[model samples]
Each structure stands twice: as C-alpha cells, then as structure tokens.
Target: MTKSLEGRVALITGASRGLGREIAQRLAQDGASVALLDRKAHWAEDLVAEIESTGGKAVALGSDVSDRKALTAAFESAVSALGRLDIVVNNAMWTKYAAIEDIDEESLDRMLGVGVAGIIWGTQAAAAAMRQQGGGSIVNIASVSARLGLPQAMVYCGIKAAVEGMTRSAAIELAPAGIRVNAVAPSTVATEGVRAMLDEATFEARVASTPLGRLGATSDIAEAVLFFADPMRSGFVTGQSLLVDGGISVALR
Candidate 1:
C-alpha cells in the first residue's frame, strides 16, 4: 500500500495560507514529508500540527524567499529535518494592484523579488539537494494572467510570464542534472486571497467567463501540482505548463 510519493520530501513556499496551504496538505496526504516555508514561520505551525495528526511528517520554516542566503538556509534546514529533498513548489508571492501609471517602484520590486527571484532561489536550492538524490521535480505556481492581460495586474502578469520562461530554461539546464522543472498556471481560483481581492460582482463575472461555469477550488490546483510532483504521474513530463483554470484559458467565452 505504498503511496506514489511515499518516501519523498517536499518543500512549499507560502505554505501558510490559501492555495499554498492546500498543496502542502495534499502532498502530505500522499505520504511526502513536507516542509512548509513562509515569511512568518509560526503561521504554518497549525498546518504542521494538522499533518502530524494524520501521521505525516511536516516542518515549518520562516525566511524571505527574495533573500538568497535566507532561502538557501531554509532549504538546507528542510533537508536536514526531512532527511532529503525530492520536490519543491515555488508558490510564495506578494502583489499589489494599481493602474499601470500608478505602479510604484517599491511595490514592483517586492513583487519581482517574491514572484521572480523567489522561484529562482527555490529552484537553485531544490536542485542542489535533489542532485544528491539523483533526480527530483520542481513545480512553480504561475497564473493565467501571464497569458491574458488583466487591468491593475501588470506586474503580476510579468512575473508569471517570467516564471514560465524560467521553468522552461531551468528544465533544460537541470534536466542534465536529473532535475525536472515545470509550472502550473491557475486562473481565478477561489482562494482566500482571491476572495479578499475581488468583489461579489467581480467574482460572479469570473465564474460566468469560465466555460466550467464555476471558480476553481484549492484542491483543483493542489491536484495539478501533485500530478507534477509525483514521478509516477509525470516522470517524463518537463518544461511544460499545465493550466488548471477549469477551461478558462482556452474558452472563447
């Protein structure tokens, strides 16, 4: 009765809330020991407890993913605590919505720092740890905003587009080292952050625009991530981006 990721160790950034939290729990349920890394370490402790209650191994770490040194240290700590590293999900991000003309330099820097630089550092750290283990998988959480222009989300869109490009380039570079890189792009998922950002009318409009006729659930994105994280499910898949937006990306509507 061995699970697909029975002996795997995974690290997920932004694991304190929303989609990040869901992904952590799902991976744990599949028997992968998880390290939940967030800006505030204590924010993830409750999730750690929940996973442990289900007989899963979990740990929480605090670090600014934008800082290379801090991120590398967190990765090292994750491996030290979990015994090894086999998977990583680059899911942490910070964003602010403003008109293109109103975009501030500080907010832009923070968004790029978290959304772009964070992925790079996470990839570097995960690859180093996985190199020793022979091979591993890394999944970056992207957004459909990368492909479609959304008002007040210019910076966020740019970051996600960069993520996809990096995923491809990193896959090619790391593939030789036995590490696979990929990304999952989700659209209008009903996460706490998404809910907080959108008004009722906006939320309904998002649903109406999707062919699926409903907003995506956190589990939906988590399952997409699991497909990439589990070697048995996606061993030969790399350098690809799966859009888990319930048909929103392709719908004519």
Candidate 2:
C-alpha cells in the first residue's frame, strides 16, 4: 500500500518534545517532509537531525507562535525549504495549573496568548499558503480539560474551549476552500509537561478514573492527529473535535 502522506509537507509547532515531537516523527515515518517549529529551536534542531538520521526529511525553525510576524516568517522559511505546505499541526501551548485565587494576570494572559492566539496565527498562516496551493489540513491540539473542567485548571480549560470553538468556525469558513480544520482533545497524556505537574500517586489516581485504567501516551495522540491530517482517511470529516481520552469524559461520579 502507498503511504498516505507521500510528498506532503507538514509544519508542526511545539515539535521540540512531548506530543508534538511524537506527531512530527510519526508523520515523517509515513513519508511526509516535516518542518519542526518550536520556541526551543535547538531542541527541534536535535529532533530534526534524529529524523534525518532515520532517512526522513525535516527542518527545525524557531518562532513564537503568538507573534504573527515571527510565525509568518517561519512559514515562509518552511515553504522556501520544503517547496510547499500541506498540513499544519498547532500543538504549541503554555499551560499552568492554578486555582482562581492563585492565578495572576500574567500567567492567564500567557496561557491565552500561547494556547489560543497561537492557534489563530498558525491557522491563518497555513490557511493562506494552503489556499494558494489549492487545499490543506489543520489539526489543533486541544484537551479534555475543556470538557470535563478540572479544578485548578480553569485558565487552561478556557483556552482549550476557545480553541475548539475556533476549530469549528474555521472549518465552516474554510471548507469551501478545500481546507479542513479540526481538533483533537486528549486527556492526561504522559508527556514531560504532564509529568512535571503530576506526581506518581496523583497520576495513578487520575488514570484509575478512566475505564482504560491508563494514561494516554504520546503515540495515542499522534495517531489521532494522523487520522485528521490525511484527507483520504478523513476526507469527509471537518468541524469535529475527536476526544482521545480513555472514556474519562463519559465517566459518571
């Protein structure tokens, strides 16, 4: 069978580590040329080198996704090097867990800016390039927090909910242009970011709540992203948010 994404060019934000890195690696393994973008450019550089060592084509670039100018430049650089753009994975986010009283203005703003505004910038930039190329796909990484509403994660939930809303609206508007926008909402993925915030006991407790009795892995989320990015696999799908949670969202107290 032919690889679904052969000759496709994918630009994945937050490709330095965690779910983003896994997603980039998976797409490259499937024969897509990848542009790995992250604020930690050096991290992406190392990852890109690893991908290249494995016989995949990739490049690393640094850009603050919330900065429209920087994002635009990054997109141009990727196109210049890769020849064209076909997919965008908006996986960058700034997350801080805190109670309402403990949350400060700066932290809240940063979360919204990086998590929400970043998606907007990436989508707009990718949409423009894709429209020019005749079509494309966008996959936004959201969270089950947006639906289940965890304690001390109010700001993070807000940002994710906003992302879901944007995905729907963009899908509706961009459908006519052959651009598909959708989101994946994962629950408690075992990423470096998540590990930093969750202790062994806390992680176990959370996992136990899920019917699957396990936390999600980066590959779990990556597979969901791959499904959305392949037009042939999901050609009829748009304006949807696929929840990658292990039945946690449906759990009853």
Candidate 3:
C-alpha cells in the first residue's frame, strides 16, 4: 500500500457489505478516510470497526441514497466528519429478478429510484462538494448486464445502462470543474446476493462463459475502483466505463 490516496476522503453508498464494503476497505487501505452510507446503517458498523482496527479512518452513516434530501445530508455529514470529500462511489441499488412482464410497478420504481435516481442525486451532491475543494472523483458501479441483455433482468439492465449514460454526460459537464466521472461495469461476482440469485448449475455455466474460467470477486471490482479514485493514476481518465468481468465482456457468445 503506497498511501496513494492518503488524506483523501471517500463516500461510498451501500457500503455495508458486498462490493460496496470491499470498495470501502480497498480505498481505506490506500489511505483514504471513508464514509460508509447505507439504508441499513447498522450493517456498516462492523466494517467501520474493521477499518478502524486496521488503523484506517471510517464512519458509518445510515442514509437511503434514493432519498435525495437524506443523501445530500449524508454527503454533508461525510464532509463534516472527514473534513473534505474527494471521492464518491454511487454503488447502492435496489433490484429484483423478474421477467419484464412479471415486474410490478413498485419493483420498477424501487429499482430506478435507487439504481438510477440515487446515482443522479449522489453525483449532484458530490460534484458540488468537489467544486468547493477544486476537484474530485466519482465512480458508479455499473454491471455487465448493461452490455448484455439477460432474461428476467430487464430492469436491472436498463438502470445500469442509465448509469453509464449519466457517467459520460457528467464527465463532460464536470470536467471543467475538475470533477471526473467514471464507472466500473462488473460481471457476476461471487457475493451472497449473487449466489442467492443464481443456482449452482447456472453459476457454473456463467463461469464457463467467462474467458478467465472463474466468476469475479469483490476485490476485482475494488481494484478497478482504486484506479479511478487515484488522480495520479487516472487523472485524465473520465467518462469511461471499465469492465471488470474477467474478459466476459468481449467473448462472442
């Protein structure tokens, strides 16, 4: 760990567990103080404790990213606690696996609310904060589903695609302000949530489809996020969506 992100402050939504938790730990390991925000705020307590135990700075803030006002307040709270905001990872999302026709109105709204609206709100808050500080970075956790349409995942795919679109537009609009916007699109990762969604046979089939012969791990996505978060390494890179899918994004299925 080179402390490349030393003294930088990072705010990550859905930081209680899974990919968000991994991103938080990874950023903290690189020397950035992290603010973990989640709807279930208590879930982040253990992660915050773990980071602190490892001599890293972190705080757990219970806030729903879908709620613009609450999310804005959380962003301010993060800045208040960490002094300044340098990075924002809009990784929170609400999704349900269902066929297009089977999807209900509530599910559709929730997915868009957290997955799409949440990103917009988070970016707006982060961009404002970063402007005051001269510049900053914002990373959105997209998905390979955005590139490949899958059955029973239409809503998820649409929301992710929206995120990618937003990233590009925000990058262009925020660049002049020194705020960079980017996204990471990951394939199926072996997380509890993903495992629950896919059966063993389906998981095996997915692994076979990937060129690397294995499902992605949380650390894989976390590493890509680190690249975008570090200005020294990716200062000139923005509006780009890096795929961390173990080469699956390129395989001609």
Candidate 4:
C-alpha cells in the first residue's frame, strides 16, 4: 500500500470475479490505475465503483480475451482512459471438467480459445502497447493443474500447462523490449466458482491432503503477483512461474 505502482496503469482480463477481481483490488491499493476487462461490458461496473470509492482509478471495458481484434481495441481503450499501460494480467479463462474420453471437441475449442489463445492475444496486445512506451509487466494466472495430474480435469490441465510454456517463451522473446513475463500457478482456492464446483466431501478431502490444512486465500495469490509486478522486487526476474499451492505440491511429491 505504499504506492509502489503509482503512475502505473494495469489491465486485467476476466476482472469481474474470483482471482481477477482480487488482483485488481490489490493493484489498485498499490496506486496502479486498473482497467477491468470482462466479457460483459457492465460486469465490472461495481468493481470500478468500489475502486473509485477508495480514491483509486479504474475503468471497465467489455471484450472477449480470445478475440485479437476486440482485445486490441480494449487495450487501446484502456490506454485512452488511463493515459498509459504498464501492467497486463492475463487471467481470463474458460474451463470444463471432463474425463479424457469425455472431452468433446466444442469444449476443447472453448478452453483452448480462452485459456490458451487468450494468453497469446493478451501478450500480443500488451507487447505492442508496451513497446511503444518502452516496457511493461505481464502476469499470467495459470493453475496447479499444470503441475499435478488431477482427475476429471484433462482439458484444464492441458491448457494450464500451455500457459506455463507460453509464459517462458514470451518472457524470452519480449525481454529485449524491457517487458517481463511471468506466471502464477495457484492451488485450489476458496472462490465462489470453486466452491460451487466442488462438493462437501471433495472439499474436505482437499483440505486434508493439503499440508497447510487450509485452502489458499485470494490475498496469498495477489501478494505473489505483487512481488512480480513491483519492479523493485522482480525487475531482474522473468519467465519464472511461481506456484502458490500452499505446500501441497511438495507434500504430494
């Protein structure tokens, strides 16, 4: 809350709810002007108001992250409203739980479009805008599914794994422009969407398996993102994927 990100402008996709919402608030608290981009134009209005109420700057725009043209326009709109772009958070994703054999073509395409293609499009848009202004930071929200093999999550796992791959490759490719690309892979967190997806027994089982005896909090993931976003902390770091899985990953290993 020291305004480390003062004067910086950040754009986050899927900014309506869950991790995206929390990350937006976190950045705003650090003095970064945030642009909330969600599929529905009005979805982030309340969030924009929330930030404004606290003396933070925010704008809400509607665009599907999977569409390059629309996404590019959204980036332009954010810059138009906020003056400049400094941080880009590619947190938009569409997911479906299915067994390997049950994964349908339509579902696979949707997942790939939002989860994988969205990253590429976001990186492209951010790189274009950041290149003009010298440099910026890109934080992709991956998942523990990328590192662990979870049942009934074949499509999700594959897409998240691609996120890690894209993060590294983009980091190397964009370094010369002074842009930094990194990934944050979170374990199961207590989000509305997650709670809705899981049943009581499964939720308790996850807690029992986790070494920390509790699920991750939105703040835990946001703090990790702050570490990467604050150039003072991670200016020299890029292409790294920080796993915020509450030590469950290690316990399983």
For model 3, residues 158-186, the per-residue Cα lDDT tens digits are 99999999999999999999999999999
Residue-pair clashes per candidate, as listed? 0, 0, 0, 0
Roughly what TM-score does model 4 have, to 2 decimal places? 0.98
Q: Candidate 2 on 1-253: residue-level lDDT in tens? A: 6789999999999998899999999999888999999986787888888989988899999999989999999999999999999999999998888988999999888888899889999999999899998889999999898888789988888899999999999999999999999999999998887888898899889989988989999999999999999988998899999999999999884
Off by over 4 Å in 1: none
What is the model-wide C-alpha lDDT for candidate 3? 0.94
Using all chains and alpha carbons, the TM-scores for the candidates as numbered come to 0.99, 0.98, 0.98, 0.98
- In model 1, the worst 10-residue window by lDDT is 244-253
The Cα error of candidate 1 at residue 107, in Å, is: 0.4
User: What value does the lDDT take at residue 14 in candidate 1?
Assistant: 98
lDDT of 1 at 152: 90
Pick the winner on lDDT between candidates 2 and 3.
3
Where does candidate 2 stray beyond 4 Å? none
> Which pairs, if any, clash in model 3?
none
Model 1: pairs clashing at backbone N, Cα or C within 3 Å: none
Q: Compared to the true structure, candidate 1 yields what TM-score?
A: 0.99
With candidate 4 superimposed using the best TM-score fit, by how many Å does residue 28's alpha carbon deviate from the native? 0.2
